[model samples]
Target: MKSNLLSLEMMNGQERLHEALEMRGFLVKKEGPFLMLASGSSKRDLRSLKMLLNKLHIPIFWNGDRFQLLTNKFPVMMMKKITEHRGEEFPVSMEGYHFRWRAFVNRKNGLKVDALDLDPHIACFVKAVNEAGIPCLAGCDGHLKHAPNLQFSGVYSGAWFQIIQEQYLSEFELNYTWNVEFKGGSGSRLVASKARNERWDRHKIYEDTLKMAYKLKEHADEIKKRKASSFKRNAGMKEEAEGLRTDGRFEELVDWMERLSN
Candidate 1:
């Protein structure tokens, strides 16, 4: 086992990940339902993956997409300067697939009685034990096999977004950690968390979100358009309105224009 772990560390990052998955019982082929990649488990990786997911167009409520993320998501990447504090978790990252099938499924976040943050390697074994991600952490007290160094845990909040069974497969050969999950998620993400939140007007919320993002991209254009226009026509715009409404100064000018038009 020590030799295997050493060889894994010696392998390039991607190879280490694939090897780990295979060791855990998954058979990796050149052509499979998914292709996996690995990267730094650093703060940069965490932030980037978070953004990717936040902007991803996949619909989580659907079974097919849920299957995709839960199974194929990459390990969570967070860094702690202190070796003891440093731990990792996983999040699904599916592309070219759809988990609409998840719409037919119903699941909840792991009972969060006492959520925890532990080593990534140990977390995989926990996943192995529960046969589901319903438990936030699996103890590293040698209760599980193949991971002696396993003494920590953490979770993916998005785990509850959707859960699918088909895309969820395992090759458990005595507890090795995989770098990523597989066979999950169809891309082209649209925000669905909004719909999940009680305070949100999902449709209107996301519409405005998208509008704001688009508006940010065309900042210069909005500025030029507002400057060139003689008549301001944005008086009654909804407060929720996003985008560069008549250049970047739309809000500042709205009151004056509203008074004039009235």
Candidate 2:
């Protein structure tokens, strides 16, 4: 019988990654719960992703743009041995235990991304791909305890190519088609909200801090009354008041209060 081993040929990093995912039975065509669903994601999570991927925004109108909008439907499964086939090396620990799991979402729209819903097994391998920013590793087992990328230790860097090519040559279908005129605002609103927040953050030092100080003072006064009643201070109240007194910018405010006290 012929051995089933993945071979590395002439494919770039991204292409390799796509292929490796296929070999492990995670191509877009494979219909499982791990596919992207249009209705599953919440408005809040979408808004956050839109803000985070703001600079990385690609439009359906853009010629090379892949995913304009997408929502992960289900989590991917993780297992030590997906099948009983041989001739391939599966990830194993020194104790001969397999490191496997359902760690994350396998489906992405134009491009694959990671947030919270990833399966732990899928998350380990997928996170490595995202962090490497390329199709450098195919799959990961346990928390790698190696050097700089110890967490990614014992990762199958070549498996990426194996699966990606397999998916492309095999039958894979895109979940949905993006419209050239598709401008319904999955993320644009979030970007605008973020811009407003940046403006708020810019002036927050003087205005926001003063507002916080006012709130703290109200609590501080209650503490003073408590202290008068019982010759001891509330630790929480003392800490808050002292924070305003000793901190750099607050020091100036504290000095102003001392002059008023005098």
Candidate 3:
């Protein structure tokens, strides 16, 4: 029973990741959702591999990636002990958890950032494991800008990897692909849109925001005159207003507006 007989099921949006690994000489066998890695694959420096994958915008499947590193015997025994497997490590819902959005400034660079609320379940699990004398630790998953770095508290240096500077398509670029789809009984017409300079789009967005702000101000006045409505309407209005106010380039937009007024 060598550890090489491990199988990991790759989820959706992970095909490119699998291909990337294979291209790198990893002995990976894709059998449906499961990916079987050769022996000694896990013992290698996984963080380095994760760092490369992060540059490609592919994250390891929640717990599946970590669990594959364990010996088959140990994983099997743990699975039997837990009995309630499947959804324990990750949420079962196809849809993601509805985490509350937050806005704050990054302490390191003083840049305004948006993030989601922390998962309480993770804390509870860590406490439970520690109380059971399992010596469990909590750390970052090293996704995207974060390195695949994981360390114990005693020896942890909370350093993140430098952002990889490469000409790659981001989520914003992918938005143009949404209108690109195959028609029924017709050959797919894959048309790549002409790339425009980002500055052009940024200028347009700033102008649109100024126009929207005026419209929202008018709507806010109208709402005041109307009868009281549900909290949903109020919350929607508040969120949009806050988003515009907190935009990182908002100060520059204000200057543009002032110049236009002159």
Candidate 4:
């Protein structure tokens, strides 16, 4: 499968590589330098393709149908740093907050040497969502006169915001109301407004946004644990299946294979 999937010669150009992907039953589209695979592709097929590519030292980002071959220009090290710093405590000072904010933004938008002139209050939330693997596009602290908001890209952004709303923000909803505004293909915005007639306080908004960041980290960690566990289980099942085939236990192997499929 690996040999037939792609050859070293095919990697010479995007046009040739995309043709190979289409022949292998992938519905492919080219968006700038990114190759977008249609969501209709099976998960197992996508996983197998990703594994093969990784073994060849090619990096690919597979998020549902949005598969893209990451170029050398991609901020791989910065992204690793963001993931590594996921467990760090919220920034206590303005400088610390800017540092975290710059890391997250640069990971998504490439390097930005200039200081990020964003509101310090919104920095923690920006860092949180981006590090959680949800691409945050824009954010504002709303000062003391307006509602604080964060914008995220892609269709899944709305679903991610829903999870944070239903599971993480339940307790905070009493004092501060949150809502998601979907902009069709433009992505979604998560806005935080005051509950009832209570006026917006900048300090409370900053504190609440920090709490939301913590909850986002907790959610991201849970996802990582589940993925790790699933990978181990699948690996063990594959080893058992291979052993069963080698030992000529056809009937037992069939049963084991069925279990593994489930």
Which regions of candidate 3 deviate over 4 angstroms?
Answer: 1-13, 31-36, 66-262
> Between the candidate structures 3 and 4, which one is better when assessed by TM-score?
4
Each prediction's whole-model lDDT (CA): 0.26, 0.25, 0.25, 0.49
* Index of the highest-TM-score prediction: 4
* Per-residue lDDT of candidate 3, residues 58-118 (tens digit): 3345344541222222233222222211111221221111111121101111111100111
Task: List the candidate numbers ranked by lDDT, top first.
Answer: 4, 1, 3, 2
lDDT of 4 at 84: 22
| Every model's TM-score | 0.21, 0.17, 0.19, 0.40
Which candidate number has the best lDDT?
A: 4
lDDT measured at residue 213 in model 3 versus the true structure, 0 to 100:
22
**lDDT score, candidate 2:** 0.25
The window of 10 residues in a row where model 1 has the poorest summed lDDT is 157-166
Candidate 3: C-alpha lDDT: 0.25
Better of 2 and 3 by TM-score: 3
106-194, model 2: which lDDT tens digit per residue?
11111133322332223223332333222222222212221111121111111221222232213322111111110111100000012
RMSD of each: 22.4, 26.7, 22.3, 22.2
